[model samples]
Structure formats: C-alpha cells, structure tokens
Target: MKTDQSLRTVIVTRYILPLREGGSLPALTEADDDFKYVLKFRGAGHGVKMLISELIGGELARFLGLKIPELVFANLDENFGRTEADEEIQDLLKASTGLNLAMHFLSGAINFDPSVMKVDAETASKIVWLDTFLTNIDRTFRNTNMLIWNRELWLIDFGASLYFHHSWDGWEEKAKTPFLMIKDHVLLDKATELRKIDLEFKSKITPEILSSIINLIPDDWLHWRDTELSPEEIRTVYFEFLKIRLENSEIFVKAAEDARL
Candidate 1:
C-alpha cells in the first residue's frame, strides 16, 4: 500500500483568501512547509466525501500520466483562523480542525479556455478516458476545471468525479453503465485515440495500484457519517466498485468514442 509515504502532511499556517469559484469553498492557504495550497475543507457543503473523491481522482489522473497538481494532507488546528473577520470563514475553520485535502497552488495558472488554445488528440484522449473511468461530470465547457500552468494543461477540481458514492447504492450498476455525459466533455471531440489509449491505460491501473490509492483515504473521512458500514467496510466497497468499473471500461470507452465520432 506504500504506507510509508502515503501523502505529505502539512500544517495550515494561515488562510490567505477564499476562492468562491468552486462550490466546495476551497481556500488559498499557507502551510507550515512554506508552500501555498488550495485547501478543500471537510466542513464544506459537499463534506468529506468530496475530499475523498478529490484525493482518489487526482491520484488516478497522475497515475495515468496526466498533469495534475501535487496533493497533500493539510492539518488545521482549532486555534487557526480565529481572527478572520468573516463569521462564515471562522465557522468553516472551526469545523475543519482536523485533516483536510489540498493541492500545491499554481501561483500564476490561468483557467483553460478552449477557444484560445487547443489540445492534441492523444492528450485529449487520455484525459477523456481518465474522466470516463472516474465518471467526472464537471469538465464541460461551462467550467473546464482545467488550468494552463507553464503553457501546459493541468487537471484540477476532481471533487465532482465519482458521483456514485454520494448514495452508496447500486454502485455495481452505475460502475458498468455508460457515462453518456462524456458528450459534454470539452475534450470529447478531440479524443480520437480512445481505443488505443484505453488499452494503454487499463494496463497501468491494476488492482495493486488501485489498492495503494484507495489506502490513502483517511479513516475519519470514511466513517464521517453514521453509516452502518465501518471505515474498512466502506473502503472495501470503493475498492470493489473501482475494480468492477475498471474491468468494464470498454463500455464507457466505446461510449466516449461513439460520442466523439
């Protein structure tokens, strides 16, 4: 499980500002390591589940050779953010006093604008294939959720992926179903190598790799709610779900290619 270096831990030093573009209320915060991060709070409206999705989705994208910011576990102490003038921000800080999810902040990155720049077929194909595997639904034109960092495309904001876990029911059916929403994906038309990329990517994300990534999910997040399943049981459910989905990737791979053509 690569338990030795699961994720680098950082302590939140200060909340620099709030980023309202995302519904999860991620903030620009400085960590004790002296690096800035876009911190996703467990106290946010989407709750800890969103953080879980963010962790898994970001790691999966990186595993597939996609460009994504480095994710970290940011620890928030209750004493932090006590002097913030905004009551809302103060409340949020108080509630998220434990481990939160964050990614290295790209200081000068700009939001991706398709009309201004274009992506190549293989890069687009890999992205489409990855999103389809995770059932990410937020990559449409309205909100690309992509950024241009150092003139390269970088993926971000994966809290919108893995939607099936919201209800935790019928995951097997959802895993096997075609993610028809790929039609709205910004890269759909440019993803010309889904067939070839599918073969390449499926070989990369094996059960061992999946287990290592799944092991990164924090126990507190898994048992956040009063669900009947223990944290370990919940983790097993996610493992099984992804295993089924990866085994059935061809369904969505074809669905995406069909949508593209």
Candidate 2:
C-alpha cells in the first residue's frame, strides 16, 4: 500500500554506457557550470522504494556527519530515456576535480586501496556506531561503500540500508557493541583526522536536511501492510535512532580522539 501508486506505468529507462578501460556503468554527461552530476536512469532493479531509501538514507547519513555526494532527480522524457548525457552535463563532469563514485564510474583519483588505508581501531569504533545507528549492514569488509575525495573520506551507495525490516528478531542486539567497526575489514582506519573532525562537527547538521530525509521516502517503499515492518515505520525508527546518535556522537568521538594510534 505504501508504493507510489502514481508511477505504475512510467518506464524509467536511462541507457547504460560503458566506461573506457572500466567495467562499471558511468553515464556520459555534459557540464553545468562546474559541478559534475551523474546521469542516472531508472533501471530494472531500481524501484521507487529503493530510490527513496537511497536518497533518504543518504541525506540522513550526511546530516549525521558522514560525507555524501550531492544527489539530484533528473526527469527524463521519452527521447531522454537511457540516452547519453547531453553535451552540457558531460562538460560539467569533465571540468570537475575530485573523486567520482557513481555506479557507472567507481574510480579513485589516486592509487588508494582499502587494504593499506590504515583504518585504526577507534575510527572503526565510530564507524560501527554510525552504521549500527543507521541499521546499515552493507558496509562490510568487501562492500564498504567508500570513496576518498580531496583526501577526505565520503560514504556512498546506501541502497542496502535498513535491513532491520527483514525477519531478524535480535537485530537490535548488534547495536550493543561497537565491534563491527574494524580497522581493515571496512573503513580505512587511517582516517583518524577525519574521524576527529566528524566528531567535532556533528552538531552542525541542520534540521531541513533531516526533514528532507523523512519526506523523501517514496510512498511505495513504506511496505505498510507487510506482516513484517513497513518502510515508513522503519524510517521513523531510524529517525529516532539517528537523533539519539547525533546527540551522543561525543561518546564515540572521544573514544577515537583518545585512541593509542
């Protein structure tokens, strides 16, 4: 019942383009001033609910002190469906500097790999605290959706978040300990300064960002009537958890600042 009943017949096709020397999907786009935005089309596995989750979850995480990429919803016409990025969008991206982590273009500007990122125990602890608060289980060792832009860490790809909606009774228990935040298994623990900064600036998050997060929930994604939980209810729960985490971020931040290494 929560599905966006409005988009029942909309065919959201944004054609896939191949990047040279790369296997990932990076849509070709033109420039707009100086910002490089990804050209994303609605794909088969990308339902409205999942898109909502990506936007809401992403915005929420950004508000909670994580670095996130800017997002936009491009409205496509019949002619624009899955077509290459226009001359403008492409130019914008080409002129831009910094890392790009689009589904199509997952490249690090430098030769940085997670294996040697030097993520320490304390930074890992803060990451675990953030992930657990968000109920995000996708940032594991192999699938840590991260990128380094301008030597700063940015989190991306949050479509798999909110797994507590599934049939897991003891999911809350996972939040009790901060162990999942490991040095090497997930984040490059070497991001100690970033972690300290993240803690220092946690209070600057605005309320509009939080409200935009709650409002972006696509109606279809709420899963209102399922025997399990609905996305709406799940998001409400997440909002509360996030508020608490933001208020208590100092606890984890202090831990990182006080770490040995």
Candidate 3:
C-alpha cells in the first residue's frame, strides 16, 4: 500500500544467503534496490494458511503498537511445479492482488540477535506482553525472532503463533494479559529503548487495514474459523481491550502493588 512512496517493484536477483534455521531463505534483489526482503512459500494444500498467518501476525503487531515494518503480500512469478504444497496460495494472491506486492524485508532492517545490545526490564516487559497477547510461544532463548532497526526493536516470523488453532480444540484461549519475559528471554539485556511506543495506538487501528486482513483470509487456513465475529467485531474487540489497557495501566500497577502488600 505504501509501496508507491517507499518501495518500487524489482526482480529479486538470487538467493544470496540461506537462513536455514527458520526455514527462511534470504536473497538479493536487483542491485539498485536499497532494501532486501525474505520470500516465504506456502506449505502443501495450505496456501491460505501462509497468507493468513502473515496477515494476522502483522496486523496484531501493528495493533499492539510496535514499530513493525510494512508488509505486503507478494506473488513470486517463478514457478514451482504443481506437486509443491503451497501452489494453491501462490495462485490465489497472485491473481487477486497482482504479482509482486511489497513486504517487510528483515535483513536490511535489523539484526536477528539481541544478545549484543543493552535493553532494560520495562522494554522487555512490553515485548513479553505482545507475545502473550498473540499466544506466540516461539520467542524462547534459542530461536528469538526480533529484528533491530534504527535503534528500535521490530518483530518478525510469527508463524508459530496461534498454535492452538491447528489443534483439535481450536483457538479457545482468549489473549487477555501480557506475558513476562525472563532473563533467559532473548534481547533482554540489549540496549533497546521503549520510545516511540503509542500505548494509545488502538485509535489508529483503521477499519480499512482490518478489512484488508480479514478479506484476505482463505477458507482453509488450518483451524481458523469463519465464525460469527465479523471484521468489525474483531476490530472492536481489539480496540476496546487495547484502550482499556492503555487508559488503565494503573490497574495492572495496582494489582502488582496489592500483590506486594
């Protein structure tokens, strides 16, 4: 959407380096481009899941008021034969939004490791809160998915979130509170500041973005249900909850005080 201002569509050059740890393969785009992005393909018969996962992940990060890079759904014209599992997703977004939309290319943005920086407890607290709200269980010591850009922390690789959706019971747990990040939490000691964060950012969570995300959800993304919660419903729930939390940070503070007493 912001591509017209920030980025131009260019052919990716080649897979320069492979970040094999997280199933991400990094590549170089045409030489003139200033940014480099990662290309993630869909799994078998599960194109819908991949797209929805990105959409939900990005949207939730934005909703939580984090400094996340802009993400666009792209269509890679290069063909993998029909036997590949993600062919369905590849065909769908390509036809719908044209080939090659823009996305949050992480490499040019930040370093994946935070052990090298100096971050404090409060900032780490907010990071843990985001993980709890999204039910993301992957931000462990071994496989941290944080990207540091321009002295700020940006979140990435949320494929492991909403894990219960894939389970037989479906996503039944409501994400109400933020999680706690321990010393073992990656990026804890990194010298990252908690600036530019808008606890009140819920007000800016536009209807258009929410609609765009919901509209793109395919019919077969694992256990995601096309339930009664409309786009507006989801938007309202998120906004109201976020507003309450921001306006009432004191509520949590008081609870902590009472616990101490």
What order do candidates take by TM-score, descending?
1, 3, 2
Give candidate 3's TM-score.
0.55
lDDT by residue (44-76, candidate 2, tens digit) is 133333455566666666666666766555434
Compare the candidates by TM-score and give the number of the best one: 1
Per-residue error (Å), model 3, residue 27: 5.8
lDDT of 3 at 99: 33
Candidate 1 colliding pairs, count: 0
Could you say which candidate leads in lDDT? 1
The sequence of per-residue lDDT tens digits that candidate 1 reaches over residues 126-163 is: 99998998989999999999999999999998898898
Q: What's the best-to-worst order under lDDT?
A: 1, 2, 3
**Candidate 3 on 91-199: residue-level lDDT in tens?**
5323333233335565556555655665565666556544544446667668777777777887776665544334422222222333332333464443132222233
Candidate 2 residue spans exceeding 4 A from truth: 1-35, 39-42, 82-112, 120-123, 166-185, 188-212, 218-261
lDDT of each: 0.91, 0.47, 0.46
> Model 3, which residues run further than 4 Å from truth?
1-17, 24-35, 44-47, 78-102, 106-112, 120-122, 168-170, 173-184, 187-212, 216-261
TM-score of 2: 0.52
Q: Write down the lDDT that model 2 would get.
A: 0.47
Candidate 1 TM-score to native: 0.97
